[model samples]
Target chain A: MTLSLPNLGLGIGWRAQLAHAILNRPDIGFVEILAEDYFLSETIPPPLQALHDRGVHIIPHGVGLNLGGAEPIDPARLAALGELAQRMQAPFVSEHIAFVRAAGLETGHLLPIPRTHAMLDILVKNIRQAEAALPVPLVLENIAILFDWPNAEMDEAAFLNAICERTDALLLLDLENIYANARNLGGDPVALLDRLPLERVAYVHVAGGYEADGVFHDTHAHPLHEEVVALVEALYARMAVPGVMLERDDRFPDDAELGTELDAIAAAIARGNIERHERGFAHPVLSDAS
Target chain B: MMSASREAISDTQADLVRALVHGTPVPAGFDEQRVQAVARSLVNKRRQALARIWPSLVKRVGDSFIAKFTEYGQTHPLPTSANALADGRAFLAWLAVKEPPTDDLRIEALAYDLRWRETPLGLCRRGGFGIKIARLAQSEKWLLGLRTPWRGDRWWGMPANV
Candidate 1:
């Protein structure tokens, strides 16, 4: 899909396992890294430096901001993030619109925040704080949460749209999360897509998820599911999403397997080549048509 | 009726930071019920996502390990202040200068923990538990730190009296 970012194309999550392979063969799309990993040290990891030397556009994704909670953004974290961004010369940096802490302590996992007006205000403020701290525009990703907050006052799409609008932040739309949310909560994934402000989305994340009993878990172990692929294809029709990266947190496939998945995502993006104005048909194979 | 600044959290929100600096438990003030409730929720979410890969972490390290680390991380953003990071670096330094006994299983386990368990990220990798300690200690980042340590990597101090 065409995107605002330069040379926006398919990419993979910057992982440690495939570092050698990636550096050796630099034909793959851009790489997205978790911001915290590179910040603690002044010197970049040799492999990352090698990738950078090879002209790889690295984007940083953060996990510990705890942005959508009652707590305020920590300046040290922001400064470190800003430092990492500057050092890496990252195209952009992003974090989840969820809280990792409550009552002034880390909860470890990215916890869902109540999608209320107050929560929205807090998230937007945190984004602004982060944006002000860094030289780049901050993007907010919608997380894959298993439960809804009891106090949620608005729907996820509206909350996301409103946050993006208010903070002037870009959206890192994770298609797997939307699919997982739809399966878990019984919502129309496409409708949720239609509800979001697609124009603001700057990047897309496609990851594999697992199913326990009937519940879909946003575990990145498995291969990219067909449904998430279709959702991404559908969204690309309206938005010029720049970077589409594959996120696998477990059971990292060999370069061959990862290559296949990346190829599939790239092919799907080409096949659906639905322009901005066209209402495209989903590939029957990937569509959830019973 | 709160101002935006009311939401500000000093590095204190990170649990590991509080515990390391203040000697607090992972979740310092919660009663048993509240602690149990949060723990249960965390375990439930982690059971499938993380447990499937590291089947024994919950039992061996307990579910609160990450929460504890993240908390400490909040306060100890720099490597010097983080005891855990310091200790982790020390293990590497020890591995570099000394030879671990090959015969002892307990030493082997310590070696195992040293290689994989020190950092939550490394431990989470698939089959990451089996990596050798010497190699792990000598990873590019850790090695870089030993020579010219960064804020997150461990430090090796020169003797005060040269």
Candidate 2:
């Protein structure tokens, strides 16, 4: 299966609080809406409608899919995504590979799944179920875990790649997650980046977090860190992914601050593009056609 | 050996969630300290998410919202079929049992009564509820300056069943 993953360039996660900033700004290549926000609504919110008319790509990103759960995918949830995709006319709808619910319990946040073969098989099947029911491609994002499963079968990259390979899913590699995991879980972010199939990365996420008592958490409310931007630069240098985005959920800074972060991201991406051109990296079209 | 069936994977994931939100023991093989850290962070995140949904409730709880929600979150789990507002309502319902029922929480639940309710599958909008009560609830929220009362043609024109 082939996906025409657009080169989304620099995008931001669409939030109502930031609606004015996003609509007024000219440089943002796309905006991602949390699919759950719009899925249950009967009609398009006026602000989102205005953004859609502005012509920038709007992707519906979901956190409630719980694709790794042992239970069956929720049909209403899948149906809602289909409705949203059709309304938004999105190229793809993305969700975390992590599960949010189990045994009729909703965690309300993404919980990491064990990296064993059994869990991988379950995730693959769940992803297929979501893929089959959704109107557009369902790209899966790698979630940040504070701890590693004791009885894991493979490294994070391998397990993520395995799921992508088995289900023919695209990747929403979150660089902040990689940085957080590398710092907390003990691994080299760049090396992990090098090991994964960059071809599968549909887009990347760069966000800010807080560090407390020598520990870093991807809170997404604070300002984007210099180290996180450096990680984005590192990823860009290696893969030249088709797109990258900024996600800020709380502690939203002023437009001046947001513009600075977005510019830093664009600059990093530009630097990587230059490196790719100098190294004679293939011109990215839809696929990794080198 | 534990079977690697889909059921096993599901159960383990459930166990992990239990550890994170419900105060269940950390499953073997995970870094106990780090998983506990993540679980704590998850509770904090819930506070943040619900704060946006019910700002007054958090403001009233002051320093205790995190502690209260952490205690409430253990068994309440989130509403599977509802959104933040409904989940906020559920949290208050849980709180009503744990702490004294504040007018703020009750009023908030009433506000949600104006919006939607829990269904077997998910939250569906209210039906058959009196528009007069919905209007009264809107006016009560106006006192908090929470939202503009449904006024002019907007509030009255909405179908009672819709």
Candidate 3:
């Protein structure tokens, strides 16, 4: 299926602390606002309004939808997200393929769901419900899991593919999450990327993490890891990525450090583009002998 | 394919959530070590979030912040409001029962107490009029806080000599 998503180019997760830095940078193509932050406000925050007026795409990213839960999607939360999307004039809103709350308890963190077919069925139902209610297209993101559930079922990529295929929803692929999962759980990050439905990816999230007690935590507070940036290069070499953004949630650094990280990502994309072109030039069908 | 009905999935999720947040036993078939790791990670995340919202509370609590907050979190699943301020308010209320509040803590708790009301649902912001008088623990000074729907919050502290 053709997603027809716009090429959002290089972007950064819109954080209040980094608002001044983001506004000063004219090269930033888009900014993703946490939907819940603006849900209670009657008017758009001035900085966000200025960004919108500047023609930077603002995507309402939600953290509370609990799409992977067995229970039906909460109508009120879904409505708030939709309203925020409409208010922001977002191109498409994004959410995780993980559950945040269950059994009247808020975990305050996205918890992984079992990858069983039954769970897949539940995710599809929830995604469709969200898609129906949202004013724009809905993109689902893969969350970083500390551990996988004990069950006999599909792997992460296959489960994501199934969800997107069934709902026609786009993917908000997070490379840092894939890296953290592979580092914590046993898997090859590059191989996992090969299996994902990259064509359905609407954007990409690259962030930083640290390993403690042999476990890599996807804490977006640190500097972007070189390995995660390499994943960005690897992803771009495979296919055309619509958008890629940096997600730094805490322990924010100054503008120069953020600029360096963004530069690294841009350089990776450039290197990947060069490799892609060279590979195309050397294709057997386009050989000089022909 | 292992087929789990919706009810089964719901029950399993509840069990996992309980294990992670409520200090319940790890569910069968799951690795105990990893579950513990995740539980710790969740607590750390919550601690960071709460610290962000209530820096003074965490700072005043000092070295014991993590221990206190972790203890508080195990019993009280995060409030449904999902607002850090509400969670912090709830934590302050819990702390008041466990230990005597410092003057700073008392004043912080008073600000929130005067500005919002705790209901069965969650913390609701005061819209009309409210007044709270708190005596500081260390200084033995009285603090008066007033909240008006239109005028916003105002606080007056007794003179240092008092």
Candidate 4:
């Protein structure tokens, strides 16, 4: 159910360090920007706009909507986000299905929610609310939760399927988060994906995370490990996911380092037997800039 | 009679998690339960604060700062403040001057916030002003990312371009 996308093969999260390098080399498939970064009416992040102009398919990934929270979705925030999406012409926007705020309490982190029918009802309503406010499809990612409720009503797969089924939105399957949760929580990644409605996946996110006490935290700072790359290959082999974005949040490396990772991601895709790289974008990179 | 397969968590531990989560009172009998509770609460509080604030804050600062705040909140969970704002300021200040954070739980909590929130910069600026913590401080040879305040107590370092 992915909306009409521009066919971004391998994208990178927009970063200041890699901006010049990317603009100079414009060979990567696309660029995914944190939507809020470019939302300001008075001022905009120049690099993001440049990427959008450069024919980079600007995919938006959000941080703080807290879609899975018990609280009602904040309409004001959604309005601003919608305006940003319209302005950017983003194909898809994503957020995690975890709560950042509680009942009268704002923790400011993506807290795990109890996977009950009661919670699923809350999630469906929230996603619909977000979808109504924005023209773009609201893609939800599976968070790498550290804790599980003692009274979970459904497995992770069933919970997500119910949400997407109701909302009619797409899934931004983050392979790294899935792999991380499989290791941390007691779940099998392959089986979980098998149960999920893979036809709804709009795209895939692959990132590097740090390991601690044998648990991998989705830090997005380190290089993507071989295992995650393999998992990504496996997922692509099963589904025709149109795009992939590699995210890095901290300890940002030089341009060459990022380029290498982008290359590696593309290589992994080819090895996975994802064909049809020949059809290039009709618009030239420079002609698309505002 | 041996203990049950899983012993009941002591009240003290539950209280610690509560205090950590809700900013409730913690009477000082520190036991293992208290420790676990405190850790859980700290993680939750840190995430909440980050979730609530990261969107606006990241816009003002950089992505690097998301990690910085997360590190501070998790490591300094038994914060010297009553709520999220004060706790965030104190944690940021602590992070600027303290040695690098090493705790895995703390780092995990930090990563969660970075992934979860798009903290507005305006809130971060208010927080910085409230705590009198400056994002940048000047030293002789280098510009330190010190968490010291600009016009508040414990002022150090020369003015910019000195």
True contacts kept of each: 0.04, 0.68, 0.62, 0.01
- 3 or 4, greater by TM-score: 3
Interface DockQ of each model: 0.09, 0.50, 0.50, 0.07
Candidate 3 chain B weakest lDDT stretch, 10 residues: B116-125
Indicate the docking level reached by candidate 2.
Answer: medium
TM accuracy, model 2: 0.87
Residue A39 CA error for candidate 3 (Å)?
1.9
lDDT of each: 0.62, 0.76, 0.84, 0.61
Best by lDDT: 3
Name the regions of candidate 2 deviating beyond 4 angstroms: A281-290, B1-4, B60-67, B97-105, B119-123, B127-162
Task: Compute the DockQ of candidate 2.
Answer: 0.50
Q: Per-residue lDDT of B45-124 in model 3, one digit per residue for the tens?
A: 77788887678888887898888988887688778867677788888889989988888888887887787665423355
lDDT of 2 by residue, A1-290 (tens): 65556767789999888887887788777899988777656787888788778778889998877787777788988998889899888989999978777777777777778788878777787898988898788888888776766677899989977887898788899999988888876889888987888888889898998778667888888888887788777776666677889999988788888888899999988786566666663534235422
Off by over 4 Å in 1: A1-4, A274-290, B1-162
Question: Which sections of candidate 3 miss by over 4 Å?
Answer: A281-290, B1-4, B114-130, B135-142, B158-162
Better of 1 and 4 by TM-score: 1
User: By descending TM-score, how would the candidates be arranged?
Assistant: 3, 2, 1, 4
Q: What would the per-residue lDDT of candidate 4 be over residues B1-162, giving only the tens digit for each residue?
A: 312311222233234345445556653643334334434545654555454544443333345665666566554543321234445545544753665433322323333333222244212121132222222322322222223245432223344565
TM-scores for every predicted model: 0.68, 0.87, 0.91, 0.67
